[model samples]
Target: MTNRVYVVGVGLTKFEKPGRRADWDYPAMALESGTKALADAGIAYDKVEQAYAGYCYGDSCSGHRAVYGLGMTGIPVFNVNSNCSTGSSAMFLAAQAIRSGMADCTLAIGFEKMQPGSLGSTFDDREPPMQRHLLAMAELREIAFPPAPWMFGAAGLEHNEKYGSTPEHFVKIAAKNHRHSVHNPYAQFQDDYTEDQIKADKMVYAAAGLTRPMCSPTSDGSGAAILASERFVEDNDLAGQAIEIVGQSLVTDLPGTLDSASLITLVGADMSRTAAQRVYEQAQLGPEDIDVIELHDCFAPNELLTYEALGLAGEGEAHKLVDAGDTTYGGRWVVNPSGGLISKGHPLGATGLAQTAELTWQLRGLADKRQVAGAKVALAHNIGLGGSVVVTAYRPAER
Candidate 1:
């Protein structure tokens, strides 16, 4: 990085099932989270030299509408949409602004008010963005269930077949995250579903025996993070609480992404793997150095597969880690203490920033009930299926 970037403040609104809260527009969600983030940073909106707003399902300049509620500061407000990686991608831009000496302070905010149920393409009139991905899956298996669940579930099934992982292993991940959610105020589902309950819930993908608990719920929420340069943090006396973003990388689909030969690749494991490798390389740290993680657990299977992708576990050995209880507290790494997307709710645009907020708290020792003891190094992974993946490493800033 040309300059160091530090996250001085982060904020989130409670995630809720879409439409469950009436008149809860994205604008209001944006205002609430944005205000809280500014307050946490001890700065005003005018201090932000630029802003990036991320949302997947919105009209043009939705970013302007959202940030105007914070202030009509007339900073360069850019709208970003990169599927589910939208939030982190926005953060990527803000961090770059600071890294390149273009800005001292910047804001990246994300908000989503999604329709309930499985996700689908917004435009039926034109070619869907995921047409190629779906075609890849088509060559491997018949498309039978909801597009989102089937895609993720098929990837899990592939892992199962290749590695002898049982449905129990996948359900176990869901159980752990749901249990974690009981302590998260922002989680949409705090029900501590047992492994048995997760296994027995109505199966969404019959082949993989994936139940509803194994999938991320569509939600309405917003999150915001403020980034500043080292000089800005020092000048503002924010080092005590700031989290240094040691390394960050955003990667999209590689050339072989559509092969579908490995359903793992079909669902973005390679993108995640490549991105994480770059992040680890830049941070001069590896999986063993990471004290905590908040990976993209959009589906329980993805969480398991991601273990290998993120280098937290060896290939075909993720189930072993789950079996040994290595993904939670008192393990090698405490992954997703925020309940993750599995229980935390996934408001597409807001999910990445929500993950960032959780890790920030963990590093700052401010995560209350979900705190990872003495968390010093944290890694965050968020991937979107048209295939954008972002991996970030963070450590506490010292005065």
Candidate 2:
């Protein structure tokens, strides 16, 4: 039988624009988050049996170098990259290590040192992993210079066309996230804006109804998590703080992921839906059971889309969920309490683990001013475009 895995500790560095921090390299970022996680776990680095490091833009074995600073006990060190889902992928492996009884303790860390501006492939000599979506983009719409906004924006517009929602719904989600960030010390942007401000901001893609404020900005940050088997938690007397990983699922691209006939599928919403469904099934919990959510709001549209994907709303009903005020404080679910990727900054590799950290805090009632009242269960959704989606569920460990 698989053992239950508990997150004993988690740490996150405040997300910031790229180049804002001098001397903040991936290795440095890793150490900061790693040490914090270890301290939170009340454990020593020597207790960690294996480590996984996740990042998108880095050389091979950067995981080795990044995590090596955490006191080289000669454990297995893995470098993991799964597009933007890198962070959660690392956490998945760590949880699996414990769940399978292979290791009692594991460390998962993710960090990104991104370049400024919209994301583009660093290599020109290779067939891009996301070229499938690019091909669909060319067929479906004029290729925008920064294709991310166009793809997501067009997807938002598609939802609007098919579901009778408006871009205003997406901007409202962004504004809500920005308002949430005002209480998040670790978020990149604390400057709150109204839905009108977000809609009227500098346009990123007109068709998608995305403006500067509606999109996640590139950022530099790090996040780390330490997971332990239930036995290990008991032995270490960490029951007071440990949070159980109730269930998690990682899903990759399936049919219609890059369909040219429908632009909405271009952002891989179907995979997110599938993954969330599986996690809910495994956890024996539905979206209704989740009191808080830390979703991959890489763009405002994605947030609205995820509300439906995660079953917080029915088909074509995400906007209605927004109108009902069910996604914020005093609602059915407090989504993105850490401000989410929209305002929290998207540091590719670090994004997922950061979500993990946020949910862990929420479940433990340690989210400070952004805390969701009586948050007993939480969920995290992180996705990458090349593409992968990981959905995780969490609850506080039993005493």
Candidate 3:
């Protein structure tokens, strides 16, 4: 944060269910999204001094493959994967480059073309990265659910037990996100649903109150963002379009995560809280100053739990926020005006950048139908499971 960094442009594709878009490949998706981001910034790909590309299920050097179509300028391309937080990790690296005076212009790109249904481990031979997480869950409870859903679901259950939050709270989140998606053309699922319908949908993890409607589906899509230093923005006369990166922090799991033996810790609630606290401290702004947010709502409960983690609400009081309808358009802050991952589709690597795109639009007053009124400050949260969590705060550039 020594030097000012701004998001000069952002772009994302309409997320589609995996296999439904048979014609789309990672390279094509990356090319289209990257092109749009470059066009949005009114800059040529050759101007980019470095690039960070993120994906989970891609081979080595896939970052190069994805960016080669833009130009073979031979710029350094770093491949990144922090599980689901891949996109935000890429963005963080881009910001670091600018802050360190390494580059004035950098690109952060994330894309994923995933296999349908629940996410599973790609390798079978070695010890899985999630072994400790899985073991922690086993010691906590006996639940038969997919790895991702079960982990988040268990956190929901803990929230219910610790905070008196009910299934109704989680269901309300799903309903709100789905309703929000109705106006988001880029969402993978724009169909609206009532809370009753959301709760009644087929259960994925019943103990944790997770249903089909409450979970983000595997998707295929890409998102990209261009970051520039203050000098670059002024030199290029891009001030009008620049959104300042006021504060950002990335945190990983703590020893307490497993030692505490809490389901919430197992699912990154602590990492998110720690990261968000750091960002808020760095930005000299609290949650009250944020006008809009795009948090990682990979599952409904995670959204509810994140409400507390982000300081949007006090501990164990996130349910009250939902009860008061404070998380929607008419609420204190519009959380996930993009419909979130549950409705927007979680394309692994692309999700964090997609959240960035939505927040950028909101800060610039360009989000159109989903725009939050008078938005100036925005916050984004993206957490990866095997564990990394990034929290970033943004606002329109100062005149």
Candidate 4:
């Protein structure tokens, strides 16, 4: 029998802007979440055989500080920084360790404290000063057509022009996700926005209307999960309540690949598809079998494209699904029910793990009002800068 890996517990700090008098920093948030996860799983901290902590802005040795807060056990800990995908990457590593018998139980944590500034510089380092200037010029050229402020708008323009998608199509996405967010107590922007409200908001990117609510707000938060082998689960009596990690895959973008089609059909998506397919093969299931999904919606357009990449919809058909109300809560397949990054807020490293936490809740039927009825199998997709993407498939133990 194949050794299955199960997520026994998940924990997350409420997503919010840090108050001036907040007591916890990034590491503290991570520790608190990690402790909660252990408590939730009914496991002791000393039982964790290894640890993986993901963070972006929390200075050097951030993971150490968080682990130390739980008491300095001599377990091996590795810090990971893969931009937005950090959390999932950390989980991937933990799963591998458990599968390989390197460790029976592992803890994966993601945390970040938002710093005020443009994130472009941190995403790519290969750009020379002149190349940076040229990209700026290209951005200007893009703005001339769409009149939005951010480059994501330029991406939206390309997707719209290519796929015949509309601003209103994007607005519907915002509305659907916001409606979902209202059910997520941890979501930062839970109130719904009218399509008109989204359309009338000031332009952040000519193609991407500020009214669309493109980016997640900067914030400080953390999320954590405990992964264990099937042997550990059976021995520990965690069988019926576990969330199985059936598949995990990560892919990085090729260098100097600026083809518009490449961005629309990201390499990470292909990698994730392959990964999800492998998971299905292992789990004896398929895309049509999944009941819920938590995908990266760093921007609205990204979600539309991801629908195609994840095999939920065909290319150019994603917009149609949006128009037909197919991606909503009661739709055939529900995406981003946690409000996604759009309304849930993205704290860099924390997002990937946040997606996992949301999936866990959905699988456990504990998502409160956002829960998909009778959810059995679910998927979580996350992407990092330079086009790194990780896709994971999960199933509740009851199924």
Candidate 5:
């Protein structure tokens, strides 16, 4: 547990808009990013002793096919699928392998080509007649929240009611993220949006306003990172070339134990906080020590809640932080400088890896226009269904 591991290099393909047909297959994207990561690390593919590939809906043997495309030198490749956190989980597994002396170098790759339309099917089974009926009822209720006229309900309504967050507040998130996306060449939606435009958008879900609910569009992309132990890094003279993995922590929700009455206390939020605290302890750092962050913004409200959960802001005070511009670049701490799942586009399995890639770039001082000034410590947070959570902390070599 005390062993140190570092991310030698990171690579990511551009996230595309929903419904846009991809020119490259999943494996092709994986190989492309993997090759780029290896080159970025100044290491040959043959030097990668092990590989971990994460993909939620790729065809079978996807990992082997991708690695074979790079170079047919047989290496142990394990495919992982853990919903949205697949990529971070894969990276964690790879780091563990290297730290345990099972491998000198490891490659973790994540890819996804999500289909257009709603993601309801991806959440759970829709086969059983009773289940489908229940889902339909739930969907109907979600569409009629706040007694219909108010245009809000459930989680979004509750969040607003408690924190005095208006639809305009949510629009601010969209505006800020879109602005950030202008600097991220790999982001799907680089076009900027004004608050007026965000306010005018049509609503999607009842409680969740249009400006917030439509955060994640379907995306097709891939990303990869290479990890090596500190011993391996020193032996290979990689002192000034790696982003150190200062800490990693994971937590899962207790099924059927979530507080159903209060919409704010999501099981995932608690799980994420627990993991973040553990990571901070392991890294010997506090929330103030984090210069940059990439968090799961599956929805705008999710990001707001994350601030409180991560202790970056007090309970029901996340809106104040956003209003103060503390979450933006050059602020107290930059959150989701890569445009997040909002404008960056969430490709499910690829999202966790994409977050890591952004952090790696920031820590290396290579984030270009979107870079957080003087960033030395970075954190990436990802959550999956049933409240699976992972938080990773990184420190630049200069630190």
Candidate 6:
């Protein structure tokens, strides 16, 4: 029989502003999150045959620092940095290890201790990784804002020009995410915001119709997950608590990203679509099959663009889905039940695993107030610039 993988345990640190908890460094965050995952799994760290650590702003061999404190086991530890997708990429690797029978159990950890401010390049000596993307973005809109907001804002503007979506659509998505965060104790900004509040909350990039609240904050936090093969789960009596990873796909930018001059494409929209399609095909599922989602909402525009890309809506019809309240609770599919990056805090490394944690809770009926009732199938989409997108589908292991 082919190997089946399951996420037996997941844990997350409450996301906070960079300086809010000065004592919680990357290692601290990783240890807390990692140990919690091990405890949740009812297993010891030595059981983990391999480990992958994801971080964007840390030094080399940081994975060792994170895992060594948990156990001195000399298992292979791989450090990963794929910008925002760092966490999910690590998760993908861990799943591969189990699926390939390389290991019966593997750990994936992601954490980031960010500096307070808009995110910037850590290394100025080398050419910036996003330079080409920014250059392509400059051709579409004036480079007035910071790199991330500018690119996403331009994409929002293009959506308005191409489709009939208005600035209110983006504002509504921000409002929804902010409101969703109120129920997520782990979210950094758990307070709700009205559309007016979001619109008036200091325009970070006015030309692109982006307000401060619509952008994800720079956060310091960590998340970790333990993945095991079916044999490991059955042997260790973890079946009842496990959540199976049904399908997953990772895709990067194609040539059209630069040559097409589409801001949406420039922001990894095509990659998201490609990845989502692959996952759906692999799982024999469609957008309608999913009951909940935790998409990469690093910016409000990206969330809206992902609606169409993930097949939640048709081309140029995402606004209608937003208008009809299909992306929220009591709708067809509850998106960003974890408050997403906007409110949940986007610690670059922690985000993807956090998404996995949220879905695991939703699938297991562990999410208290944020739970999507009768949730059976869930989907997660995480994207990073330069650019890589990972889309994964999940179902309860018992099912």
Model 1 lDDT tens row, 28-64: 9999999999999999999999999999989999999
TM-score of each: 0.99, 0.98, 0.99, 0.90, 0.90, 0.99
Give the Cα lDDT of each candidate: 0.93, 0.90, 0.93, 0.76, 0.77, 0.93
Model 4 Cα lDDT, one tens digit per residue, 1-399: 446789998889888764432776876788778988998789998989999999877667888888777768899999998877889999999888998878899999988877643354444657632243235437434434221124444555556777898766777887788878998887878888787777776555554554547556676788999999988898889887799888777766543434434434332455555556666676677779888889888777777767877888876777888977887777888999999988998888789889999999888889898989999889888976454788888987766
Give all candidate RMSDs, comma-separated.
0.9, 1.2, 0.9, 3.3, 3.8, 0.9
Off by over 4 Å in 6: none
Give the poorly placed runs of model 2, Cα more than 4 Å off: none
Instruction: Output candidate 2 Cα RMSD.
Output: 1.2
Clashes of 3: 0
Q: Candidate 1: deviation at residue 57, Å?
A: 1.4
Better of 5 and 6 by lDDT: 6
- Model 6 lDDT tens row, 35-99: 99999999999999999999999899988898888988879999999999999999999999998
lDDT by residue (1-399, candidate 2, tens digit) is: 899999999999999899999789999999999999999999999999999999999998999999988988889999999988999999999899999899999999999999998998889999999888888867976777688888787788888999999988988899899999999999999999987788778988887778999899999999999999988999999999999999999999897666547776678888899999999998999988899999988889988888888999998889998988899998899999888888999999899999989988888888899989888988999998888999999999962
* Winner by lDDT between candidate 6 and candidate 2: 6
Clashing pairs in 1: none
Query: On a 0 to 100 scale, what is the lDDT of residue 61 in model 4?
Result: 80
